[model samples]
Target: MTRNTDDDGIVVLGHPRSGTTLLRRLINLHPNISSPPETHLLSACARFLDADMTADGVDMGVLAGLDFSGFSESDVLKELRQFSFGFLQRIAERKGKARWAEKTAFDIFHLKNIEKLCEDHVYYVAIVRHPLDVAVSCTEFCTSMGTYPSTLHEYIKRYPQPIEAFAMSWLETTKALMDLGRKRSSRFIMVRYEDIIEDENEIMNSVFQFVDEEHGCDQAQSIFNSIPEIGFSDHKSLQEKSIHKKSIDRWRSLPSPQVKRLGELLNPLLAELGYDEIENTGEIGTTAARRRYATSLALHAAKTNETDDDTKD
Candidate 1:
């Protein structure tokens, strides 16, 4: 299970609640792969760099004001890269595995930075899920976590409701990462969450094969087959302790009005992802409603950041 100092590492990324955790656990079951809890390395680095550079000297408020004593930006980046490799490498070795994988939903925003930091030693596997399903899951999770929006109107304004935000995030993250994958071709792969749920063996085998090809190893499919039923407690404490088809079309149960609104906001992307959409529009219009929706979204963003900050503690 020994590896060269420059061995390739795997990265699993997705929109939050899009099955990234499940993928991590599934891949970790393989004898040759070591998957660990999210390090948030890439994300933290991206945020640091962003916070360090400010147009008006006040981007992240206090973060922008704080000064690093002697380290230059390049110094910071180099140190992060070294730490990332050192951490994952040690985990892999401890597990007697030849390869390591890192999963962080937040990494979805910093793919290019990650690529540059990992150099030629990183490979990506981006997972995508249906927007409706993602929104549904997000809403349920946030509510259970006590972060859900109050009314249907409020939900329409913020995330875990209005559902438009999830659609936008999914489309943006998927498109951006897919673009990176295509540009890097051999170094990146995109897997759909639905595909993994429907045909796990086939999708997982392909993932393992990708890892093997990149790392110059002939991995056996039996390793994947041997993984027992896996489960996880999401942010809401909802347990997905085993793989099942129960969640596949849960969005179909959504009210017709909400579904129509989602379709209106995300028609092209939904259609591209092979989901049904409502082609007609011209519904739900009013100045007051528009203002409320905008305010709701702004509040939602603030609340989301608050929750994220709390989680970091």
Candidate 2:
């Protein structure tokens, strides 16, 4: 398939509450970039292409019908690619922008399939936040909204605790994108949410350059000048249009027990992602109980190390 430079788009990948919406809004401030709200368009197309006859106890024989009509897999994929590009291109054209970007946090899980649908025509920008903060934000969002979204709702059912569910979600999504970045180094870039809050101008300049767009510090600043209510996004961003560091360490407010559990769940990835480890002490329990817990953790670590040494030997 011939690629049109004008139709090249970007996919913003991240877990929920990981600053993907903020990144998308900033990217939209560029005159040449048109990033709409969460559409889940690429994932939708991927599902359609992979649909089978017995999905969800329903007869989704669309692919079979296409095959019966003499369309090859490549033929259907080509048509879907054209349709996807044309749909987004028309959006960009209407907005008087040369490029379009899509942000659906759940799309991180389906990236391998989405990449096949869009092939090499899309650039990926993955924005990640500390998992503990992400878990805290997810809990707060669910509490305030009075309902859990499908993804979080499902995760909540699987894990004994809500924070663990969110931490696992963050780990899986961030790990998937990070692995992809290694494979597609030239086409993928990761933006840490903390960096954006700490240095907006420099971080956004690198982001714009990643997508082959000019950096306009003035336009980027315009994000705080106005807030557009986007659907399926962090509404807190709409409420507080300005970037600040207040939420950077929100997990600290969680009780020590919860914080310790999160540290156990996310410490390695947190360190790998260059965030400081969550301190597991403070307000956890009585002094004696805390010492027992610490000693147990040490014993477990020693046992694991012994196993590793045995395997090496």
Candidate 3:
């Protein structure tokens, strides 16, 4: 469990709700490493030029000022790289975690910038989940409940399916990282969300070996056990594993239409990710699937506020 002063870091990337938080906690469990909360630092610091950078949090007001399309050219990306890494280096030093790591789900959406930040003595752990689950989770995220559709219909604007978008996004980002790994051959690693969920110890052992190999850190299970087992009380604890045996696959019970439609949408991505694409089951327009993964404490908070209002009346 001894800390190594060499100070290597890792960047954990996946789309929002795709298990990046869980990944951070698992890795931080290793004695020689540290990752403070799910720091969305990569996106914030990379956008520092046009962004009003606070100490840790990105200002919502500053974010609203510009669209993503307005980002600068290649010359600007290089400038932003130096500024972003300098800022992150300071943050990591402040954290007292000799070997630092950072987690941000949306960082995958900005793979190019993420690559730059980790170029200097850092590694990566990219996590991917099923696209259907991602869409269902994102639906709850964007609308606070699952009201998203899985299929495209004629005369219905023919919009891209949410599941499809999430799937394609996961594949594209992971591929980019893998491509980088092939070139560097010494700087990156890949992981799957399902693997972590199914057998955490095995996955953690693998990660520990990789980290130990990359950086000369002496690590053991005792140090990992020392990492607190924080439960998911609010959104904050998603970075820690929820103290529940939450199964990862909930789409099985969803109605056939949705399942079929979602299958159609994610088929290409499934193939790309080495997942078998299920055939449309002649049931492609139902709505029985819905996301219900919010922390109970959040629901309780809402109920408590409502009750307080009634008591005042």
Candidate 4:
């Protein structure tokens, strides 16, 4: 059978730190597919077209003295769709692959626009993670990059406070994206980060099923063998090969107060995402977790001091 390479464009999207990158890398390992780091093509195109200029509703007057009268809105839209589809097809062909996958969380906001442009040729996968875990990971990530504020007040003054804001943002983004997915359920799938960590093969196989393809269990496992130290733009690195169980439930190590606040703010959305509701016991088990965290910090400090002393000696 002749392959319609242009029709196999896959879009992987979720909030940052929601395992979208890892999923894209794994998908790329398939011999038939390849994904370059996110191009943000559709999102950028949508922004340039502006909110008022939709696929079917582009106002020629908005072009600001350009000669768009030569073509109708439908004419321009058909050309735009052809251009978008051509971009994916050319990339896949350049890489000598039959399929191309693109990952960019920003595209979540523009899925409807992309659909209006590309129609049935695109497949969407929304990666969902526990809001609490997402909040903690995003917080740690920003701090490691030296961009996060140290205190809740300062954080709120600049950006949203971590757990509350991040969790709420995740809820809002995922729900909006999923709502779009529901209208075209056959072409969309939502995969949980926890499920991927638990059974990478199973989750990937399900993803393959959504794309109407045979399972690539061997390709998936092979890709999991040794993670390259690829970063988010080569600055924030994944320094580990094995997917650690520690990646799951990362909010547990967070200070009790933060965790409690997250639980409170995120319980409804958590339930909506099919996670167990956080039990609202106030700081009952706080001490033990706090002590463990404190001891780890102290040990880290001691190790650093020892290394300095040894260097001096």
Candidate 5:
């Protein structure tokens, strides 16, 4: 099938809990853009292409079968690329929109495959938040809500502390996305979650301009009126009717010891991303902040059966 590269698509990339959903909602507010829920389509395709054997050690056999049937690997891949775009394009058409954008948490890891699939036809929007804030939020979700249990388990096995695991995740994912942004500056842009909350008009205008779409900042306040019913997105974002700075610097409320540990691991990346260095003075936070921190620690301890000693100053 002949592809129309002029009909541009967008892919939003960021670590989980990095405000990609909020960005997706804002982008969807544009009359011409249809930002859909997490699909992870490219990752699935990449896995299929890269997998040589199944869990039981049996060969995957699909490619070998296709080879026997006179189909080359390139042929199958070309069709897969076309299928991905067509799937998204049809959804955009159904919504009466001219363009489509997809947001999935793990998509940042599969950008090379996505770039091969869409070439110049897709634009990337990488949203980032403070690593400390991301780690705090992610730990809360993992321990309290039981979200991403396997991911948390894997990280726990690798790192000595949950906050360290989450901080490393943010560092790796953000570095990968930032590297791609530098390589493809024309087709890529990075948006800070704090900037969006602080200056919605300017940040969003630049985002739209990057995607070659008309600016819709006038309707940004109402963007949440029609939140997508995607199950895997940040549920908290769906509840919010507008952007706020409530989550900004949430890491400040965490205990000093944990903050200092996170600072030791993430301070370099924080500087690279233009964020302030983490200050871990052993000072007491507000009542509410301390209460929240204590709750998160309790939840983490309960979930992992680990002692909360490390969190103490």
Candidate 6:
């Protein structure tokens, strides 16, 4: 079995269906590289911030006051990250590889913390996809999974928000990283999701070359060549027709009205991202402004969650 180095690891971050999984599968095939299953460290940290923070229903602010740092620096979190890395490293080494990669979309929300945990720079490979498509898939999942919100209006009438929340956050999170990378472009390497599906070889080779030169790793072709032609569940064949591309975009089939609303909500971010509507869909400037106003209303609703303990009372 090969024990891989913590150095030269890479992280793929973005909204789901943005090709992070595909990219990780491709990169982990490199001989000098290793990558683990989606460890979701960044997602865990995001949960600490944006979602439920504890079994006791305490806010993250309260937890911080009790000194999460004391817990953070303790053996628990360190061991968690290390075990996650080391476990994957062992798997890669047994496969005769030298480096490892991890792909988790929600990790971008806690990029700073992930960087600190690694303490060694890991290049971020950000992934992005069409919000309309993502929203449709997410919405359908709610129906299929029997997790639909109780009310038609997810905001005031029901719970768990909507599939649009994921779509909205996906745009905001990508924008935040793009904003950071725009300032520190040297530290960031970006690859578009379309580049993978549309220009696979070119994008893959360029990524391999960049990681090699950037990390000064030895030749990595052995691992690169081992990537299954068309990945599926472990026991499955990699044939094109047999392969399940169930994950591909299907939002085009949505009702025109709903699709239009989705486009309106995501238009600014999409346009700013150089994404055009497939059939010249999506709203323009005014629609994006409306999204902001809607977001402000949601923000006020969230503010009501605060307690007296959270206040300076």
After the best TM-score superposition of candidate 2, give how far the Cα of residue 203 lies from its true spot, in angstroms: 0.8
TM-scores for all candidates: the values are 0.69, 0.81, 0.61, 0.74, 0.79, 0.60
Which segments of candidate 2 are over 4 A away from where they belong?
1-7, 50-69, 227-232, 282-313
lDDT winner, 2 or 3? 2
Report how far off residue 147 is in candidate 2 (Å): 1.9
Model 5, range 1-313, lDDT digits (tens) per residue?
Answer: 2335564888888887888888888887888988777777777776666546668885565665687799986788778877887787888889999888988776766666666565556788889999888888888877768666554566778986777888888887788888788877778889899999999889999998877767965677776776456557777777887788899988788668678767877888888889988875665457866797799998987866544444552
Model 1 Cα lDDT, one tens digit per residue, 161-274 = 446666566667777877777777876777888888887767887887776633222332333345332332343312344566777777777656567776766778667766
Question: What shift in Å separates residue 126 of candidate 3 from its native position after superposition?
Answer: 0.8
Sort by TM-score, top down from the best: 2, 5, 4, 1, 3, 6
For residues 78-141, write the lDDT of model 3, one tens digit per residue.
Answer: 5555555455556556656456777766666566656654464466676777766765666456
Per-candidate RMSD vs. true structure?
A: 11.6, 11.8, 11.5, 6.3, 8.2, 14.8
Per-residue lDDT of candidate 4, residues 257-286 (tens digit): 666766887788678778898876576565
Q: For residues 136-227, could you state the per-residue lDDT of candidate 2 as single tens digits?
A: 99888889999887867777898868888898888877888888889778778998999998887899899888777779655555777775
- The candidate with the higher lDDT, 4 or 5, is 5
Worst 10 residues of 2 by lDDT: 52-61
Best by lDDT: 2
Report the CA-based lDDT of candidate 1 relative to the real structure. 0.68
**Stronger candidate by TM-score (1 vs 2):** 2
Return the lDDT, model 5, position 13: 86
| lDDT accuracy of residue 254 in candidate 5 | 69
Clashes of each: 3, 0, 1, 0, 0, 13
Better candidate by TM-score, 5 or 6: 5
TM-score between model 4 and native:
0.74
Candidate whose TM-score is highest: 2
Evaluate all candidate structures by whole-model CA lDDT and list the values in order.
0.68, 0.80, 0.58, 0.70, 0.78, 0.58
User: What is the C-alpha local distance difference test score of candidate 3?
Assistant: 0.58
